[model samples]
Target: MQRIGWTRPTAKTMRDMLHIGAPIFAELFLVSLFVMVDTALLKPCGTTAIAAVGLTAEPINVLEFLFFAVQTAVIARMARASAKNDRNAIHAIIRGYLKLTLASAALLAVLTGVFAVPFLTLFGGTADTLPIAVPYFQISLLAFVCRRMYGAMATILKGLDKPQWSFLLNLIANGINIVGDIVLINGYGPFPKLGALGAAVATVSGCAVGLVCAVVVMRDQLRAREIRIPLSDWLRSTWRETRAICTEALPMAGEKVMIRLGIFLSITRIAALGTTAFAAYRILISLQNFAYLGAEAVATTALIFLSKAYANHDRKAAQDAFSAAMVYGLAFSSLCAVLFFAVPGFLMSCYSDDPQVLSEGVRVLRIIFLYQPFQAVALIYASGMRSCRRAGIPSIITTVGIVLVRPSLVYLLAGPLGVCGAWIAIMTDEIVRCVLLFALRGKMWRQFTDAPTPSPAVV
Candidate 1:
């Protein structure tokens, strides 16, 4: 029987994952979709707006990557304690995570606030983009503190097997942001137009609502679970773990930077074909998130299950979880790929009315669909490594493949095939990562399990 903090998910576990995961997938996908919407709506305003928002994205992603790294570690530790039936440990981790997240968020917020413009310039901004990016960047970073807080809280609930609440809160928030998009961007009865600034404001407001809802929903978990965190003990352990998290997380951050830059360069190439191509690519990217969520969900679910198994010293259980999760991920991606082919223009039309944007988006998105299954494989195993607390290696390997191999090929190919060439470059990177990571997955699991650790004391 399941007790306070203990859980031994059976075959039914995967089914639970599906129910809880669907909302999470929706929320995550919509967050990206909102970004696409932000860009698409501003398209009439022009490329300055697109580049303005785009310039700020890499920096925002950097902040999120840091938050996610800590959150990932939190989930792993929380899952370990839960597997060993330690409710007290849940409280302790939450307390520690709360303090750490707040402190980190504040520091980063100050740094980003002070250096927002310079950072945007570093990502390749010009004077025309700066004015638009300035307001967008400033206001968006204001929400990162709340965002990081939500990250820790969401990880706590998800690791404890109450992921549905976390997902629901995010969806609710995104829903608010979507409505705000139309109202604020175009101006409602009394509301004045804010354009890109409106999008940023909408995002911050939505996040505020979501953060409060998530905390409220998980109030029982917070209060009912008794916690006694000793500051001295926390200082010692948190310091060590914090350092270790960075060693692991920095590469993950770097990998994201690689992706952001590669896309940036790809945009530079696509922009040559004019705003229609650039705008088209952005829309297609937003649509791809719907297909991409399966892989993201697999990665997240795999990490939780693997961390639990590794903590319990159950090598066989870990293998079972990984294989079962991965097969489902593959099936999910395959289905999405089929939809992409069968319904080409449907996704493109959501973003724009321009015939060129629609046509180019259809052509490019169809080819990208061919690579979706491969992207799923890469996400599953790379995240499997994260579950084992060995994310660095895979991050490095994929980063090299993406930032170096992929973009270099795109540069070579784009001249001949334009944006289509850029898409091929991305496809090649996903395929390579899929093959390499899958090949190494078994060996890596074996190596990690060879020295499995027992669950530690909870409180």
Candidate 2:
């Protein structure tokens, strides 16, 4: 039997992890900045506009899970293919998944646009917010395909070990978005002020640019000549790749759906707390996103490294990779925690100057700050399990937390404690999930190390 122990990562291990993680971190940071900038810009439009925009976040996320499901599978497959230097397999996976993602995104966008009013209403959009949210959501759908395509391409780039390229693409896209927000949201010169609608238009424009740039970069990066084959053969290869992708994607899709459902339910409860509370809740959530960005970047790096290690049956490498991810993720989250704890009021002030919003946001932000370390553990371990194709158990664990534990706690707590209670429920859920994931991951590590060789399928 092989032995596995908790070992500290070496210098080389840290460097390699940093090499992969830095770009991913930058990319995620830019994405978060996009949200923060939008929120700040929307301030002048009033809390209703801010709340209206926030109303669209979960619905849009639920819709985007279509892209996310496929993206996860693509990254897993592409990591394996890159490990083997199988250019043909990589090309097939990219083409098949990209086509499917674009079509699905387009279809979902149309349906979402058609049902925008009803969908926003279901998320607890009040009369004031509905008018603003519906049009904003419908307009945002125009960029749905482009945004999804950019995400798909970015994953492919990461799989190919070219994360910097993804970061560069996003930087350009979000720069455009931020500038557009200033000009369009407030109306400058020839452009009329569009308020929340302006933010939606800016998003559409940025996503479109990002998609085009991603295609160009992808083409340049994939310089391999196309394999000439009969149409039947081509179709067969594409179908096989798509089927494999879908098989991996289905479980992830369920996990994502459950998470969004939890958020959806949480939003309904918060929305009932009135616009001030809801808006404050939204701003704090946006601020809290900073805490996760580093952890997510490290998790993505761990996923790619774990995928390759599992594919090659390199258990030691996988162990070291996981260790590096946990360390890096925790360290980064600690920094964010300090910032959250130190100046909760200052951070809250960035989005709104309203005294009540600031007070309410500061209260919840501090609660969220305490759970950042646990949040990091949960994210890294979940990604680790997924990389080994053992996503089912982690998915189930997370689903229970998000679907059952979280909502139940919120339903019980939110009434008496207000927004603070809702966040406290979230914090509890994170700690519970973190502890469970840590134990499960240890068992998984032992199984991998004890096996004579990596199992051909998930153990």
Candidate 3:
């Protein structure tokens, strides 16, 4: 086959990635800032509130990962459909995944709300924190449906090469959340002070608004493309697409489950270190997540464009996009590491006034900063693998790192190294995952090229 024209890693393509990745970076960073704002604002409520929120994070992450798996599945498949010019397949996949995810979200919301106490208690929620944690968990869980809609629509836009639309929608959502945080958390003017619950309310409300905005943007995009699905056939198409989506999503979901479980175990260990230690971790983790925004954005772009490249059978384009994505991921993540090292104290101080908490937070931040680049490489490589429909190996590698090695290291090290030990466990996990996933990049390339052309547009 002649090397078909596709996006090559020329100056123009590089510029395209920057333009695509910049807003994605901002979007992710803004989302992280939601947690940052919550942690910072709730500090006045006392350390228990912070610990409560921190404890709830593990379970919430599991839910986010589930939806994220669905989003990735959508992007991986839709990229191919777009590349193949299969308008019908794209529409079917979008409708199927959106409906399936929203249904899952709604069920999840109810289950989490009903079992909020039991779930929080499993994470070492105490009497004092449970009162705060349970309400927050209940209200926040209800937002899962909204979040699912927002994430699915955003992923669809990305697959269609319309990332700016998602970015703009997310920016509006973040603005709403920040304003809501100020008003609800502090009882600005007439609003009553609701503490931790208020933070949950603001974030959930923001997600709901984001879903609405995303729908509006997506409608315009679809209309522009003149893509319309007949209502009578919608359910029939959705059911057919569901089977295909689930086949792709299951392995990724397993990977997410294992990773979240690892974090869950790590959180349990951190809780044993006491409220001050966990609180410090909460603050430092928020900062660490902020740093990871760049890597996440690059990984997202890699998945969409690389999938498109491969779907078009353009190996060189795939290679170029993957290379450019890794470079972008590492560059931004390394900069974050530098910032973390230079001003760890200031970053911690933003979240807490407690001296011991600040000391612990700074120590954790420095340790985590050292491993950010490794995480960047790992995320990009894994995303590339997934884009090529070789998700199984990456999923296995992640499962081992998160479910077995990391938690064991944490369990053995936390007693001796305190919060630093927990940080070391995570760093170790990132390094292992990076090495393993990087080694498999060639295999992924071969797997995609050597395999028979898939039926229709199923990823």
- For each candidate, what is the lDDT? 0.74, 0.83, 0.82
Residue 321 error, candidate 1, Å: 1.9
lDDT of 1 by residue, 108-187 (tens): 88898888788888878799999989778888876777777776778788888677777777777777877887788778
Assess candidate 3 and give its TM-score to the true structure.
0.88
TM-score of each: 0.84, 0.87, 0.88
Residue pairs in collision within model 1 = none
Ranking by lDDT: 2, 3, 1
How many residue pairs in model 1 have overlapping backbones?
A: 0
RMSD (Cα, Å) for all candidates, in order, is 5.1, 3.6, 3.6
What is the descending TM-score order? Answer: 3, 2, 1
Top model number, lDDT:
2
Candidate 3 per-residue lDDT, tens place, 1-459, comes to: 232222435776687788777777777776776656667777777888888887888778767777888788888888888888887787788788878888888888888789889878876788888988888888888666787789889989988888888878887877787788888987889899988788889988888999989988888898888888667655564676898888898899898888777878888898899999888887777777776777888998888888888788777777778778867887889899998888989988987899999998888877888889999988888887888788898899999999899999999999999989988998999999999887766777775566457576532
Which consecutive 10 residues in model 1 have the weakest lDDT in total? 1-10
Model 2 clash pairs are none
